[model samples]
Target: MRTFLTLFIALTLGLGWGLAARAEGFLGVYEDLPLAPGLTEVEGSGLSFDSPGGRIVEGYATGAVEAAEILKFYAATLPQLGWARDSDTLYRREAEVLKIDTEVDGGALAVHFTISPE
Candidate 1:
């Protein structure tokens, strides 16, 4: 049991560190998106950065890979990052897009996106 406990703690710490490491600008923002339910499309307002502004996209869904913006936000914001789709679990969301249970192909949350340095 000691070994198992040690492994568990290590795994937990690793996961936290991973999340923190990925937490930059928008990626960190996306990570904090709430998961509730009754979502169909993206919602949110834009902000200023360059000339016009960057619109904060928000989408709501329950247990389905609906919007790609939320995941893409992290993927594009992170280096060589991307998200997957979760067809196995149902997700409910509120406020921002919730990166739900995604396949472990890349990251824990199937973000379903691509990171571009542009």
Candidate 2:
């Protein structure tokens, strides 16, 4: 069952390595920012930190999802997830991490993050 779930997610959401895959109960505990719907993680695009401060996820959106929509989703949702958006940077008060999203392609939003404990 675990293998199936992993395979399903890999096929459906690309090679993801987030909290959802490790601890379902923890959910967003590890992944401070959520990936937009239909976005699949590009292979070799996952990065994490030993300290609870940094993680980066890169992926492309499937279907006809536009970049604007994806940006809107993050703009609206990040705050609800305890992130403060100052210009293009997202600072998580609760997590102490900084996150920024950029477009690598027309439908791809690459989220770059780093831990800032201070």
Candidate 3:
């Protein structure tokens, strides 16, 4: 009985740790910008800098997901993160604008994400 209880405690801690890590966002692309599931960041495709205006970030990710699904995901998700949908591919927050562009690359969909000062 003691051994079974110990095992359960260990599993519970492990599951909680996993969930916390997953909530930290994928790829570390941009803070508060959620990467859609099934997409992975492209190597050496991230750029970030701070200008007099504000910060700018650019990155790319690729996945096998459909374009419509990607769009739908962001439309539903971004607002929850304080981003307002300005258009089908653009979102605006307090002082920044995020632009998302996707294209078919080989057999995968490549997404380019850009965030700039508004």
The collision pairs in model 3 are: none
1-118, model 2: which lDDT tens digit per residue? Answer: 4365435545433444442332112113233345566454444544544545433333322324555765666666556545677654556554465555555555545544444554
TM-score of 1: 0.19
TM-score pick, better of 1 and 3:
3
Candidate No. with top TM-score: 3
Which tens-of-lDDT digit does each residue in 78-115 have in candidate 1?
Answer: 22222232332322222212223333333222332211
TM-score of 2: 0.49
Q: Estimate, for each residue in 15-118, the C-alpha lDDT of model 3 and write its tens digit.
A: 76322223224445565566776678887889889999999999898999898877877887667556799987999988999999999999999999999999
lDDT of each: 0.31, 0.47, 0.75
TM-score of each: 0.19, 0.49, 0.77
Arranged by TM-score with the best first, the candidates are: 3, 2, 1
> Order the candidates by lDDT, highest first — what do you get?
3, 2, 1
For candidate 3, give the lDDT of residue 54.
96
Superposed on all Cα atoms, model 1 deviates from the true structure by an RMSD in Å of 15.3
Cα-based lDDT at residue 24, candidate 2: 16
At residue 53, what lDDT does model 3 achieve?
100
